[model samples]
Target: MMFASIASVALERAQMTRALLLRMIQMAEMRDPEETGPHVNRVGSYSIEIFEKWGMKHGLSEEEIDKKRDILRMAAMLHDVGKVAVSDKILKKRGQLTEEEYETMKRHTVRGARLFLDKASDFGEMVSEMNHYHSDFDAMAAQVALNHHEKWNGRGYPGHVDIATGSPLKDYAVPDYPHKALGKKEEEIPLVGRIVALADVYDALSTKRSYKEAWDEAKVLDLIGKEAGSHFDPELVEIFFSCLPVLRSIQQRYKEPEMPSE
Candidate 1:
């Protein structure tokens, strides 16, 4: 084969490897809804919303943005792949979990990283970074997935405080020391995790759980808006709301149509 053709084959192989890793996570989660529920679908959709916003805000080249969009879509799908490791007892808890049970449930991030690392060693860095720090936005996207629960006024989890004091990642902290004054740059965080956080929380709140009634989209958006400064990035939250019309279209297209009124 020509040299260019050989290189193309190699690149395709790598892409296939990454794709297979994602598929494994999805298939496993699908078999057990209690573990991830309909979360993957919601994450996929929300991540696209965030990325599209980011692309527009940054004015990225179409080709570059498209690549980023693809990665965000795949990343969103695998965000909670760690749940597959949790025991069914915890994963399927119908009511509020005991403190210990909740703590155990939280370990899915570490578990998920291990799962991805074992299968797709090439993307180990991305998977591990996302699993451990997707919620940690104090430093940027690096911290979002790990620290998404963090509040602007403080009172989040894991660290419980903002990265203002200092991010756990020395590298991220070095760039912005004494983090308190770090004006929110909503663009710096991982678009994939930010979007997933919104989707995960919205679906979790909206879907009827054993303990609580599901809230509709408008109610969920209201809550999200109320918490924008503390719980979410205001700009991104605005983008989320702006995209609601499109989101409704997505739901209408993919979700089963309601049965005719009888």
Candidate 2:
């Protein structure tokens, strides 16, 4: 009975820590108010739905999938936390940025990763001493943030040298800034990262932004199908399609609140 009580208190404290971290992410996103919709919440829901379907089809036991689902869901929300470091002129721009500005914008992925990395470095020891589960979640969050921008065909940004070729930026010149490179592709990308990538893109396409109108559901699904093996993992994309009905329900439930017109 005493052990049970202690465990309950630990769980409550963990939940509080998670809530604090999520609020930090929200504050960072508030910097670019126009882009901050219900995106984080919607992406979290979408990722869990996709991960569940994909896990079941891939032969993962229900227990295994259930154990990691919440962590993955929470981590997905931090995928864009690095954008806080982006300049207002670039992040809030109403029009296309020049190549230079776009390059600067891409640094958000690295910056986001750095934020979690710093957290992991600072609190990792303390969390591990208290609860390994919390430490694991922090590490997973960092990984998802770092690799969410990676592509299946290896064309994604914050490029790293392919270990095989020893060439980091084969096509484009290296950026002036420092970045981490995982050199992951397809199944190589962490499942959590892959899930968040699809969720992120789906939410972005389905919602309206300052630069473009919201895309129709059919158009968005068609684009997902078209990019299955290139922009997304083919198998996960199949699972995503299978769960479209549920995905749509989540979309409706967390539908972005209408913005006031200027």
Candidate 3:
């Protein structure tokens, strides 16, 4: 009886921590109108769906996958949290950015990664105090933030830095650090990062943004299919298509407000 009571309290506290983290993500992204909606929620949901369908093929047991699902959902939200640091001029620009502006924009990936890594110990302690649950997910979340921009072919950025190595740097704004290109191939990227990458791209392509109308769902899927080996994990792409119905249902449920015709 005492054990049950302790377990219940732990679960409640964990829930609270998750809620707080998600709210933080929303607040961080509120600067950009395009990101202020259900974008984070949809990406998290889409990642959950993808993992549910394909996690086992990656060698995780059903129980392990189930345990990690919530963590995956929450961590996915922070994938773009570094955008908070980007300038409004760039983030809200309706036109394409100049080369310099685009380069600056990519710094968000590294910035977001640093947000978690820098605070990992503190975050772990807080979660432990709140829920008495020991979770390594803070580190995992940092990895997802760092690597979500990485491509299967290794072309993505802020490119190929081994973020697992701790840094003494305190200023998150300055991205000038020695980040070596480790030359990671498809399987080398963390599985969670790969999953969120696909979800992020899918949501971005299928939804209307300030610069463009939403592409037709068929076109989006076709592009994702075509980019399988180079842009995405081919096996995960198959899993994505195999679970099309659920993905569509998720899309409809989180349907963005329609843009007025120009």
What TM-score would every model get versus the actual structure?
Answer: 0.69, 0.85, 0.84
TM-score of 2: 0.85
Give the per-residue lDDT digits (tens) of candidate 1, residues 148-259. 4334444343332232223333333323444322222344434454566676676667665556776887788789999786666676778878887776665554442233
Give the lDDT ranking, best first. 3, 2, 1
Off by over 4 Å in 1: 1-4, 11-15, 27-32, 35-38, 114-154, 159-191, 256-262
lDDT of 2 by residue, 140-216 (tens): 88778777877888767665533223245554444663333435677767778888888999999999888989999
Q: What's each prediction's clash count?
A: 19, 1, 0
| CA lDDT of every candidate | 0.56, 0.77, 0.78
Strongest candidate by TM-score: 2
- For 1-262, candidate 3 gives per-residue lDDT tens digits of 9999988988888778877787768677787677745788888899988988887666878888888887888888778887887999999888989999997787777777776666455655566566313255676777788778878987666555545442223332224543334334688788888989999999999988878888999999999999899888888899999988988898888887766899
Error of 3 at 151 (Å): 0.7
Model 2 worst lDDT run, 10 consecutive residues:
161-170
> lDDT score, residue 97, model 2?
97
Q: How far is candidate 3 from the true structure (C-alpha RMSD, Å)?
A: 4.4
Residue 188, candidate 3: C-alpha displacement in angstroms: 1.6
Between prediction 2 and prediction 3, which has the larger lDDT?
A: 3
- Point to the candidate with the largest lDDT: 3
